[model samples]
Target: MPSGGSTLNAENSGNHTLPSTLAGVDPLSQFLTGPRAQAAFTLRVTMDPPFAIDVQDQAALTVIAAIQGGAWIIAAGTDPQFLAAGQAATVRGPAPYVVADAPDRAATVVIGPGQSCRTPAGDHVDVTMSHGVRSWGNSPDGDTVLLIGTYQSSAAAGQLAVSALPPLAVFDTQETDPALLGLIEREMSRPAPGQESALDRALDLLLLHLVRASVDRADAAGPSWATGTRDPVVARALEVLHAEPASAWTVAELAKRAHVSRATMASRFQAAVGQPPMTYLAAWRLALAADRLASSTATTAAIAQDVGYSSAFAFSAAFSRAYGVSPTGYRRAAEVS
Candidate 1:
């Protein structure tokens, strides 16, 4: 497939609701609906064979999917993984890595701040070949086509999502919703009005699909959060926790909600979530508060109340303890960055 052949199209069949167990546990939904994710950064890269690019240490999570030929991903401290056409990979960063036709190929350029690229010797390497909208690379007719979706915010909720993932994860396109990818590809090449907004939504959907597919692989060894969603009792309790983060939930109350004995619920929740009920709830509330701080214009007191805290002082203390920064300070830093 040629790079220029990719076209942006309107309308798609990818719009769908969340799964039953995952309905209220919509982690991706929360991430996307939050302020930072709304401004998601994305790119469409086109390249010929014998190509390789390295991205330096960046505290961002990237979703890379191929649309044309194949490529190989080599993240620091991990083995090289190959990605065929239609396949996708998530590269968790704060570390450097390389993407190329093969593992042996050295990086020809380094991607830096603002997605700028330069030769290893520090000479600027301009991506003069632009194929379609938001697209750039070595050639406009490059054989290898890639869609890159990035989530670079350091917000607490965003970090929580990254914490549940392995440093490098891959899944086949067959496991993804075809329509979502189709919509992403179609929208990537159009400079139409509100295109950035459209791309943000599409990228979020694609990330959700890829992450869910990775977690749902038949192999049982997966994150406790993902595996817990499969257990009826634990799933129910999780749904409650997610649905009502401000409910001031207690262990017994959550157990009643899950329709199980306190002891039984405690044991199972521990096994499935790797944490006790109250402990999990505390973490969840803090995460919600963090997202509210970064994404909303609500007052500290209001945000605190929304996440179960009745006293603004108590919320500030807890928020500071968990994040080492006051809520206002955290919001300020996020805004500055």
Candidate 2:
């Protein structure tokens, strides 16, 4: 195996132990409940000079973080973007792109399904370049090093978490999630029990970090979901809604809690969150419902009650309208796909 390289599998990595204190954390608990980051395809690539790889797998999401040296990324329809050490970039995919020593360098290898690789001349290079586990590269000591993680099957909630954002976004050096990075690095090579589970969880946290950072930037490119948090009134309202999605909340009630008049709250919420307060609440409830449906085997009626629907039929209708599929159908599709 190449140094600092390992393929992580949930079954092979062993059972992970979690602290009792972290049991009910909303988003984190939801992420741990299902297929959010279960089978992450991760790799550490080490390369020397004149190296470039074209990624064609087009996974749902691809995250590239620099570890050792700087690299250039040529995203589709975009100019080359340089990633210095300690910086990271996320590419929303199904689109092919190139990562190389320099933006001008052509791809010498193509990464395909199952992470198999082949040269331009149709020569198989998987075994020749395979370092160990999930590691693949030209040399273990190459100056340019990167940690790549791909989410092949994104969970419903995970999708909702990153609903806003363009195809390609980069996190500046200052925004790097160092805590999660350190945990991943520490567990990357441990051949002990539950290492795979630990790695998967770490990777999930890393993805969450990237997604939140993308939204938090709130620039011309930032998503409204993130920018909404910038408004104190809207942020407080959001916290209330997220904390009690099952509550029958009205705009007047939400406004009362936000300490703003109904009219002012409505106007500010619409301005900041890009939607009326009630509309955002409805969407948030549905998003929570989707997460439950995808991650749990609860009855539709039970799930409906948890998300504030009076009847299963009502919940089903709303879910269908929002996701284009019934609760049961969505669950089945999430499992199979």
Report the lDDT tens digits of candidate 2 across residue range 187-285: 654466776667777787787777667666646354354567788998888777656666667779888999999998888889887887777767766
lDDT per residue for candidate 1 within 131-226, as digits (tens), equals: 445688888778999888776654565555555567787678687666776778788777677777787778777776766776677663444666
Model 2: runs farther than 4 Å from truth?
Answer: 1-35, 121-123, 164-166, 177-179, 215-220
For every model shown, what is its TM-score relative to the native structure? 0.86, 0.82
lDDT per model vs. reference: 0.71, 0.70
| Candidate 1: segments with Cα more than 4 A from true spot | 1-25, 57-59, 127-133, 162-164, 220-222
Give the number of the best model, judged by TM-score.
1
lDDT of 2: 0.70
